[model samples]
Target: MAGNSDPLTPRAKLAVTAGKAVAAASRAAGRGSGSVIGGRVALKLDPDLLARLAQNLDCVLVSATNGKTTTTRLIAEALRAAGPVVSNALGANMPAGITSALAGGSDAKFGVIEVDEKYLAGVARDTDPKCIALLNLSRDQLDRAAETRMLAENWREGLAGSKAVVVANADDPLVVWAASSSPNVIWVAAGQMWKDDAWSCPSCGGVMQRPGDDWFCGECGFRRPTPSWALSGDHVLDPHGSAWPIHLQLPGRANKANAASSAAVAAVFGVPPQVALERMYQVQAVAGRYDVVQFEGRDLRLLLAKNPAGWLETFSLIDPPPTPVILSVNARSADGTDTSWLWDVDYTRLTGHPICVVGDRKLDLAVRLEVANQHFQVCENLDQAVQLCPPGRIEVIANYTAFQDLRRRVGN
Candidate 1:
């Protein structure tokens, strides 16, 4: 039964039961997690199953090119302080997976959903969330997803009349334009590390003029909004200007930025910044990201970086000099078929590390590293790469599918 609504109709209830059965069967067969397939079956039976499941919960949607999964986890944890919260803890952000998540947690009071960028508008329409968090947007899965500006336009069109309170990043011009149509917005100055995709204004198509932490269009004046919440060096400033130190087990400034965004979104659900931060601090790892597992007697820290923007943040989280770093790349369907995005990453920053490369697309990554004048050794597999590393902590950074491959092998 839904937490705040009437009982599900007979059709929807049957759909939910069948979906759960399929999901369980999938897990038993080890085919996959079955979140997507199960939800697909359910939706096929009852097209409105997602909306039906979401009807009784105060849903919150988190969507972005990067950090959506981690941010979703953070917000879910923070919301738990208020009551039971349901979330797709795995990296399933599509409609089917989201439906599965909601159907599975029907009794929960809150739904924290991680939505794929392209699917955000549809999911938002179906869920009618109380709050939506638009994190940074950058070039990711270019072969499969739309360009940043097109996505921004889609968001602008889809969410034009949404009654949800949008918690958006003020630093990114693209996000600013996308959320510009919303009547209720809480802008957070979460820093944007990759600015290449947002140089052109989404409104006027003019070159954006960025001056020392602020951005504005030169031709049509589409500017960055004044954020009520801001992320400083190592702290997050609330709307009242009180700075809260972001102490997290998660690595890098990106996670700090994610924390700031999560805090702001949590506040919409009546969770105070102090309480939210306290709950979020308990999340050490999000879906194998930043998880350190033992592989052949050495500690292997797994970091997932699918695109250039993600790689930038992952590089910052690497252990300093001489720690053996394993760079993995894949061009599977999950990872974009094109590996050209490798050139956009700064591999030169990894100069001081003992770098070992592996994955389906290692040669492509090798060429990028060579162009940057960085030395690396090519290994056939993760095990072979780990064998080459000296004893102690070994950092493994991989793209989408490659990371999952290693995670399964290492039993994370």
Candidate 2:
């Protein structure tokens, strides 16, 4: 439909008719687009339909439980520095979205996409990518996905039967163990790790390494080697909300983790560190991850939390010292049919003493905070929460539905 406006077309009308017909039939078959998938034709097409589009593809696929969107976008930019690239640089990481990206860029030499854990195997099978960057897998979306170990096993299967080279985070026990025996695997070290202690031994299911970030198995003696790229240093945010030279497109160490993961994948595409750093300067933050705003002369930082693991990371980023906050949550089946994961996050990080809570499930957020011995102010609606903010300082945290509610309020 988009290309139909082109001139000098004799059979173009016929081609447009076919495209429209194909798109219409898909909707009738319960495979329509525009909610998660867009433009009925772009997504409803099958593997063979996309198979025809995959030619001369030099792909870099990023898969993980977290940080995929930011890292995928970063790797795409760094790959562009190396040569021509085709990427789903947006946050669209599903199978249909990936197919749409490939169809849109059949001429590109490389394709980079962020993939979900449940879909990694299918995506790898369908796309047959050149390199697959697996970020650390953590517990997330237990309702929609399998257990963390199950996802890792699927990734292991993908790795075993793949032509793609693997670049993985060395600090993570799951990723490090997988990389050790793989003939075509590269280890990318974490610049820093907030979590110093590791859990069960990778070898004998006994207690693993303790003391600092160095990982070692007490049972079978399998250990982590020094990383190729070590964390140089980190800057801490002061009590006054001022931090030192933390120059990144996004906020939080979690994002720095994203930057590091992207830089590692960029290496697979042959992008030099200096060039990657330069591209980093040009890169902008992904819209939903700590997307900032200036409201009533205060800063509004919006973070999308999907699970307990990410919720912990969000807490770590917002460490101590009374800062104004407005947190929101929702219960749409898409955002986990159950909000039970809220019980696991250590939410005391909202140091402002009394965070403003808003949403249909505002009580859920408030109750979670109160149970954790934190304070909060509940509002019936988002606008009331927005109005409750003093004319000075503020920050907003929103989940799927709450995000839409805020957008309606402030046009964000």
Candidate 3:
């Protein structure tokens, strides 16, 4: 066993040990990896366990409505150029999961955490991270999570007095509003695809004027900050005015934006753009997202799109027409119960593709697709969906629970 060197108090130490044991038992029992459950047990014993575990570590928290998991993974990999770093690589961003990850990596020099948007403030308070990356915020899980502006307000209030250096997306007005009050902020011009949520300024409730990639609120004089790091088409422009090409295995503009932000965050940790980009190129998948696996004689590439904003970016990543695409959606608790977000996405873009709909919310998706005039086949399960497609590479886009279910079924 890797021994934890942090000088945790006796109670915290016992809690961590118990948590590790429970996690191990969970793995042995063929249940899910017990990061969450173990952390839950540990927090029950010692509420301060996460803070204690995070002590003496240089931590970075990445939060956004989308791309946080991938961005976290990228930042972690880039930071690996520095030394052994602890991270919640499984996309567990809540307090419990974070506690487990920190407890497990007590000896590490750095911690890179993916934080859920709603919990960013709490996590930041506990971790006291050296850097916080604020990615773009969009309406997501409205049934469960707060609205984008509400989340931004919480973030703005939560980060008001924090000493952590914030790396924020300047193109996203909400993100700008949230991170503006921070003492130290590094602005990055990471593009925002979904604009519906940001048209109204979060600062003064005035209509934002966006002219050629720049946003300004005429009423409050709030405008997009000049970015220290900017993403040009297929390239990253650093503060030094050097343009570095982004050659990532991950697809689409979203990952490129993620990589740009990651490189900026990596620079905060003393890793240069070249080294960070090279390290980031090695990441082929994040938590089974974009994983290509052979299942029943078909090559299935998995993609996750949980909200309208995510779906917009995901559409650009799908292979062109003629490649069969399976879209699975579930309204499980993990996925927000509100299916109305479906209407917000432009499904017409998928008109030319071979589409298959599956999961608990297939009917809802089918109705949306039908209204969009896109033809699709409803399948009972992933197996039927895959069988319905032609033999060769197929694309699988699913929401949270549906993606996990299909991943488990495909044994990836």
lDDT values for all models: 0.92, 0.64, 0.93
Q: Candidate 2: lDDT of 164?
A: 78
Q: Best by TM-score, which number? A: 1
CA shift of 1, model 3, Å? 24
Q: Candidate 3: how large is its RMSD?
A: 2.0
lDDT (Cα, tens digit) per residue for candidate 2, span 150-198: 6666677667757777877778876666555446776666533434223
Model 3 poorest 10 in a row by lDDT: 1-10
Distance (Å) between predicted and true CA of 118, model 3? 0.8
Worst 10 residues of 1 by lDDT: 1-10
Which of candidates 2 and 3 is the stronger one according to lDDT?
3
**How many residue pairs clash in each candidate at the backbone level?**
0, 2, 0
* lDDT digits (tens) for residues 1-412 of candidate 3: 1245656899998999999999999999988999999999999999988888887789999999999999999999999998889999998899999999988775688899999999999999998999999999998887989988999999999999899999999999999999998999999998988899988889889999999998999898999999999999999999999999999999999999999999999999999999999999999999999999999899999999999999999999888999999999999889989999999999998988999999999999999999999989999999999999889999999999999999999998
Residue 348, model 1: Cα distance from true site in angstroms: 0.7
User: What lDDT does candidate 1 reach at residue 122?
Assistant: 96
What is the TM-score (0 to 1) of candidate 1?
A: 0.98
On a 0 to 100 scale, what is the lDDT of residue 33 in model 2?
A: 34
Off by over 4 Å in 2: 1-45, 191-198, 202-204, 234-246, 295-298
